[model samples]
Target: MHTRDPHGCCYLLYSAVVPESRPAIPRPMERKILIEAGHRCAIPTCRATPVEIAHIDPWAKVLEHRPENLIALCPTCHTRYDRHEIDRQSMLAYKRQLQQLQNDSGHPTQPLIKSPYMISTLVIVDEHGIQVPNPFKLSEGSHNFECMATYVDGSSASYDPYWTCPLLDRRGKFILWAVLGRQRRSSVAISASMKHERYTELACWVFPPDGSERPPFNPCSAIGFDYSYFDSPTDE
Candidate 1:
């Protein structure tokens, strides 16, 4: 059967000859038409908020962007169609009726449904700029450390070098050890729970000279990388 929809698109109901075992039904252009129809249920007497898209012309029978052949429907109407309560002829009638209603009301714009993607922040980098395939664990609590600082003698000017200190993690929890070099000779060790809600930045400095070396680290790959609580709402 051939028909011309309100959008002036010609379509043929030729799916009757297609095999029932076709992998899946196709409705590529149906969604765009539904979006153009406003995201409201197309059925009369229902007026339910639409959460699904339906083809006025069964996708199995036809394929084309005939605005008169697309409808925005709530899940309930969709389920009714699946349950065999709504036949093809009635559905087409409803589709035309809905199109007329939309034309009369002068409202054809639909709400834009934004679909977002997900991303992870736990990335590890080494000196060569390569990422580690395996994950590493961090220890909690104050890590005691020793650094060489000059000890003052009787003259008060004579100094013996070395000092012991503590470092704190992002959560204020003590992180025992973090490797800064392959030999592990120099490292930033933290101890105790973090006092701040979140640490925006991290930098290290060597003593005595006061500013000889300072390195900034990313908090995501650091101790606060366990973001199990930050769920992406778009995740299926």
Candidate 2:
């Protein structure tokens, strides 16, 4: 039997069925929708991945699983939409933006420069907002080292780096490591632990290859790290 839903989509009602004879449900078409959306939340300014599929029209009203009726949304946005904090019109606009992004082919790219050799000074800040000079120093051929840096509530802004360095002390306690690269900006990932009961911050300053001048540390410029250089098993 077929019944028209409120949004004019027809849904089949199974009046009688054997428990083991039911057809397999179709794969969630929303998975394709999320892929077309670059695996990010459809909402602008929210780059969170692994989003949930939300219906533009409430599923109860539409009873449709079509791509045009579905959108990728982060858990927070999904909850807000379900709770009526975001209205249908706004959701539709975000969906349109995603569609445009998928269709656009003329997006400009950032210019790349030769990788410069960088000099790094590691700074460790304690939970009390005190800046302490890192005792460990970067040596020739020592591209990676581990140390801890703590941050108080107001000490630094939240940022994620491209490469994450996991640090551990002699006793196996979690510590923070700030690794610097030759790029103009650095990337960091912040993880919180209940046992440690403190926030950690990673900061870096990228110097020019010629050592002509020193750049000051700016906490506001840190951003998410891009790891496109790494080769994966999927690569041909």
Question: Which digits, one per residue and each the tens of the lDDT, describe model 1 over residues 1-236?
Answer: 89999999999877555454533324566655565546666554354675576665566676444556666777887777766666766566556554444454466643211100001122233333344322222234533222221111111111111121224676886432232321222334433333413222222222211223221111122223222233324456
Q: Over the full model, what C-alpha lDDT does candidate 1 score relative to the true structure? A: 0.40
How much does each candidate deviate from the true structure in C-alpha RMSD? 26.4, 19.4
Which portions of model 1 miss their true places by more than 4 Å? 1-32, 35-37, 104-236
Q: What lDDT is reached at residue 194 by model 1?
A: 38
Task: Provide TM-scores for the models.
Answer: 0.29, 0.35
Output candidate 1 Cα RMSD. 26.4
RMSD in Å for model 2: 19.4
Per-residue lDDT of candidate 2, residues 1-236 (tens digit) = 89998999999998764344433224667567878677877765454666887788876566556788888888887887888766777677666655655664687432211111111223433334344343322222212222222222112322222232334567877543323333443323243322332223334433332344422221121122222222223445
For residue 162, model 2's alpha carbon misses the true position, in angstroms, by 34
Candidate 2 off by > 4 Å: 1-25, 104-236
**Residue 38, model 1: Cα distance from true site in angstroms:** 3.9
